[model samples]
Target: MSKLTMPYQCLKQCGNLLIAARGSTIETFNLESRSLVSSWKCPSSKPLVSETSAQEEVTAVESPAPAEAAPEESVIPPVKRRKLSLSETPAEENKNWKHNNKGKNHRQAAASTGLDSPAVIALAVTSNGHHVIAVTSEDKSIRVFENSYINLKHELKQLSQRTMPKRPCGLAITDDSSTIISADKFGDVFSLPLVFQETPIPSKNETPVPATTEADSVLFTPAANHLTVHSVRNRKALENQKRQAKPKPDSSGPEFEHKLLLGHVSMLTDVALHTYNGRHYIFTADRDEHIRISRGIPQAHIIEQFCLGHTDFVSRLCIPSTRPEILISGGGDDELLVWDWENGNLLSRADLKGHVEVVCHEHGKAATDGSVDGLKIAVNQIEWIMVGGEDLVVVGYEAVPALFVFQLTAANTLQHIQRIQLAGNVLSFIVNSEGVVVSVDTVHALFSSSEQRNMAEAVDVQPLSTFVFEDQRLVPGPAFEGAEQRHEVPAEELGRLGALLYGLENLRKREGDGRDED
Candidate 1:
């Protein structure tokens, strides 16, 4: 109680990054230094807790605590290595991606799993990897947690005191270590500088920079309205970036210095930094089916080129690490397009249309895990892209959300290697050198984004009543009466197929009987 109480006093003001899940899974990894630090694994089923301290203490005293006695399943594991900085040695990341594959594909169901609710909407961790921030689906508030013991298997000290707007989506911990930027479904975003009542900075324009620091800084998606740069430490350059004009209240809300970027009419899909020739460029994708690149600047300069090719909405987009200038875009048309981010030219393209067609947003859908509306996702939003030890880690949704591990060859094409299945559809994912962190729809079963996709294990689940299609004719089942109308399938062939089904069903029943007799 003392440890939990202490962090709350100052946790709100510190800038710590967060990794969250829709309901499937939540993990924290330092983006500045790519590595996983902590994870929240939901239980397999709800459990009953003994309120008495004696019971709780009994579990902790054990050398290796029983997995069931886990105080809070959302456990924060100790980070063995310092977070890998993007600018640091790339020998490791480079070695694996150069090879066709890196880590062997793998997937496992979460240890403890239950109904996906109280879904994690947002996540944040501190620069030093000591603190954690999480937003829940039910309340839409931010809670702070910290690591207190280095020797423990898990440590999370909660420090949340208030709630923010409901359904606030994107969250970023600024480099200045004070401000946190979050976006909601309405295309609106908020800039809260630790413990402050979210100062509504207007939503008619684009979201400005979210944080400030000496090294790598993260800002809101410039595709929307309002930009606020708030840091804990006083600075000179950012001070120059602020508007001299005073704050004025509008009929609806307060005004901000940086006007929102109005160019992108689509739902802003993703935000990433392109550090090229010693400068950083910001890139964005929207529902308007366009990808826009920003002039390399803290405030960003003129809108650069727009990459176009998709017939429908561009759902997912990323810049593969191996090919820095090259960008990947997945769309509603079930196609993947690669582009040259520099000149906005089409480089190489592929069609990923093997799955069922009704599944939309395989790449872009604005949602959080475990929420009612957030759980209805058919496809996953493009959450995180990591140069898997050797392959590119693509964490996304299918009919449900999932994470995928693939390799790119010298041909600069995606080589389908292994697929990982998740319990819930993958909503978002993040990767660093430590581990791959993924946020997914947790309403169903939960599996890691790193699982091997055994197509044979893809569960060609047999229906209770088998319907076989032979010679393009549907042998209708007994369930549908008078359904033999000749739309395309012939009646004799249908009967023959029915006979085939009867034979199979009988054979299955006989096998069951034989097993019982044995």
Candidate 2:
């Protein structure tokens, strides 16, 4: 039986080390030596119990019991009785009790998933190369690891892990690497300290609040009785109010220190931090075609401006270090947009659909007469690189087996340069001093068509591919040694693995206009 291979979903380059995330495992490679340095997988799902707590519990149990105090005068309190109400009948009470229990059981089952493992969705490395951060899916956690060189070899030691309130879709670290900015699908952005700190437990000597108090009873008291409300709907609402008067359990948010930086009405797709004139600004893209520029950190609430030109969802944002004033954005649009983000101006738009069509034709996935319609394009990544003193922009689209290169003109416009074709769909890529290292899904084709053939038979495919610039043009470089190794799984798991690599197209909204968006 054919086996399924897990592809790399995230890639980062820090100094001489290259980091790649495949499923729940993180692999670090020495770029110069082209060898795997270390691998770290996500921790187990079982919660860790501290030894101190365990010992304290044991001491409490094994220690001698307090002497029995002499019983004071046996005073029997008088029993207070009240008449049974109509709604308090034993049958009605039992029915309500059963209903409540069912709801509670459902909630408990949804909250815990047993031993489901987590997958790494986002990865980052500090500029100093002292730490590596990764976000996991199942637990909605941010994991930090110490990237240290010990025993004559590199190693990744987990430092801390903190669960977030929501699953983060994009992550960005501050310029100083003091804080982490996370954006979730719920349209909120939060900033957390890079280092995790445990909250101190309350001292036992402190006074504890009473579980029940006289003032608490007032909350359950209804405002209107049967005398004031006579309508059927009002009576039904009153009954519901009485049924729901039970005290609810406290559902608190995350205990860790975090601040709400900013928010959007639509789901955020990407986030980038840029510094200009010694002032840092945050660029956030969303599914609503908005590219908002806000102040960094403490002033994140203040909106600077919006670069508005995209007609579809914006999935990726790129701010070149070489050109801080220029902002490149792309997503479901047919063209890549160039913006002067500082001034909120649209400088130019470069054709992306034409290039995509060219690739489809080359791969025999579209008609030869140039009549391809209902085709969707989503730019997954936009990266900037400098080759031979010239600024170049590399763009990769979702499910596209080619990397498009463009020249960033002095006028802040994009000019088509070249397209480096690959054997499979590009998942992620990182540019380093050596060249470009890309992670791809070699088992999948660029697009689906009636004439589409098996990709493995049509072209040579590999999990990892490399490219380098020669005379201002991109060419295939030497293969990355020991980097192509992939974890094999049963063929039945291919659908699950493919979903993790090719989900950018899911951001497109369907309007039911009889048109296929992706």
Candidate 3:
């Protein structure tokens, strides 16, 4: 993609790709012309309406006047034409929707060009690996990438139209890559159409269809089976009564519905697909700090059980290839939690305190900002838990472009770990069933282990390890409250949970070694 670059101008607004990098300050190349796109600053995932309403921006551009001015009255006042958006607002009433107009908004050019932000935090190729659906951490907007995941060389297309609940944290395209499901910070779950879109036939080729006066809606042509929702919860964890669990010999196998899976009090982070006794299920990652495995209908997406041990946010989850019921999760506290879908008990929690301790030992004391005791780090930090095709557990940290591998099994055990650090920060990485990990940095990408290690050990390796390790004061156990499984969790319970973490904080000593344990 780089060698083919030509020179091109920067884009007006690119909120979608910005969140794809987890709200980090990233510079994307105009690969065609090889020119650099502008830097993007993704605002937090607040309602877009909130920002628009609060801002009083300059509205229009002043047209240039002829140098030979004859009469002062001959000057034509600039047209007060409002910017038009096709999808939003009625055609007769064109209210502004997209921000920072590309042409003629001289008055508010500065604000529009302030930054180009990524609207999606996580993007996933569907189970069948056809479409790409992404969630923006900045605004919870869900953009369904228009290209199939079959070829990376294909031009990726995204629209700023589809949206999720709010503060979307995670996204998933279904097995067929047709349906998009995502989780928000509040443990709310949402679904959107992942359409296989195409441009209408050229006007010259075909007769136009009759146009309706009503605004054209973004519809899911092969719409979701909102009825016959036999089971909404995809977690195949429970043994259904023989009478009720009997697999219907229907052509489609399972039914579909627009059912609410559930909710968490804290922000939900991730969700995974599972199957039990030939039934599908879903497991959710939540701030309530629980790995909840649940199965039920949309109206009752119950939390069957929870794997709780992490003291902070559950950041990432990796489902295994060999064993469908097994999965691993990484926590904000640097701990990894392994869970068994069938059995809800905590499978294992890795002693990740050592990973950091060794780094601190090698680097002497961590670089402190000097202002706060927390080890100053990047604000939009992301960690990954990946499983290789042959059952290897891979831990990735964005701050340090590092990869750690462990032998993993169906029983949810990790052993014989190998560490291969890469140069620069691990901005993003992807692994498949075959034990291969492709890591991305500011510049180059490395797929082979030897090459990645060599890059990490390079003498001129640029470090992106600025992080602030503030004490994640143990909040109360209401942690999993943010996991989006069931929606009606009580807020009062969450408050009590917060109280628990606060008390634990006072009880646990902040060891000088930087490991605060409760």
Work out the TM-score per prediction: 0.44, 0.75, 0.50
Per-prediction RMSD in angstroms?
25.4, 13.7, 19.7
Model 2, residue pairs in steric clash? none
For residue 186, what is the lDDT in candidate 2? 70
Model 2 Cα shift for residue 63 (angstroms): 36
lDDT of 1 at 325: 70
TM-score between candidate 1 and the true structure: 0.44
Report residue 144 deviation for candidate 3 (angstroms). Answer: 1.4
- lDDT of candidates 1 onward, in order: 0.42, 0.78, 0.43
After the best TM-score superposition of candidate 2, give how far the Cα of residue 466 lies from its true spot, in angstroms. Answer: 0.7
What are the per-residue Cα lDDT tens digits for candidate 1 across 168-242? 444555544465555443343455554333364557686765444533233322322223434544344455434
